[model samples]
Target: MNMAVIGMIAGMALAFAGYFGGFGAFLLVAALGAVGFVVGRFLEGDLDIGDIFRARDDRRR
Candidate 1:
């Protein structure tokens, strides 16, 4: 399965968690989804750790 798709589905699962488990569960699931997304991006070579905190250097704006 595509990592992006899996991340989206995992994020959506928070809706069900909210419905049955409450706000805490929703938040936890949401966090997990975010972590999963980052991990997936890292694994897929789409995430650059340095870039996450790097200042924008673009001057074309």
Candidate 2:
């Protein structure tokens, strides 16, 4: 629950920064969010998100 809240705040920060023309802040938060998300998945023993999401072109019998 705490992580969820923090994630929400980070997302808001990214958006808020973008609105105020703080591109660096926006990118920083986005990078943090991306890294944190990927790390969380790693801790959970999940593979890359791209691997989790199968492409339509790769769908075959």
Candidate 3:
């Protein structure tokens, strides 16, 4: 559930929107984004790992 994954999903949603149009596509994108964000947060917390921007290992050193 990385941001990159979410972005790719969002791109998919847009592609769907282009084909399907309107509310359903928007909702699908929203759901995908939310799910991705939650999964990303859960993984980060459970694994004690984080993105470089948030990890700040160098600062700690």
Candidate 4:
């Protein structure tokens, strides 16, 4: 799916959490979504662990 669809789904999820589960659930879902996104990117090889840890000046040119 495209970014728009993904965003819509995420919004819907947050809305549901906020409506039924309250603020804490909304935050939990949002945080988990972010972690899921990062894990997905890492598994897809689109994210490099070292890139996140390395100093800015140490990055490849």
- TM-score per candidate, chains pooled: 0.69, 0.52, 0.42, 0.89
Candidate 2 per-residue lDDT over residues 1-61, each given as its tens digit: 7978987888788899888868887887788888887889877988666665888677563
Q: Model 4 residue 42 lDDT?
A: 99
Which candidate achieves the best lDDT against the true structure? Answer: 4
- Per-residue lDDT for 1-61 in model 3, tens only? 7879867877787777757878787777777777776687777785334443465666575
Task: Name the TM-score of candidate 3.
Answer: 0.42
Against the true structure, candidate 4 reaches a TM-score of 0.89
* Candidate with better TM-score, 1 vs 3: 1
Misplaced by over 4 Å in model 2 are 1-10, 48-61
Q: Highest TM-score: give the candidate number.
A: 4
Off by over 4 Å in 3: 1-20, 46-61
A best-first ranking of the candidates according to their lDDT comes to 4, 1, 2, 3
lDDT of 4 by residue, 1-61 (tens): 9999999999999999999999999999999999999999999999999988999889966
The ten-residue window of minimal lDDT in model 3 covers 46-55
Those runs of model 4 whose alpha carbons end farther than 4 Å from true positions after fitting are: none
Give residue 8's error in model 1 in angstroms.
6.5
* Model 1 bad stretches (over 4 Å): 1-8, 58-61
Arranged by TM-score, best first:
4, 1, 2, 3
lDDT (CA) for every model shown?
A: 0.82, 0.80, 0.70, 0.96
In the order shown, what is each candidate's alpha-carbon RMSD?
Answer: 3.3, 4.1, 6.6, 1.2
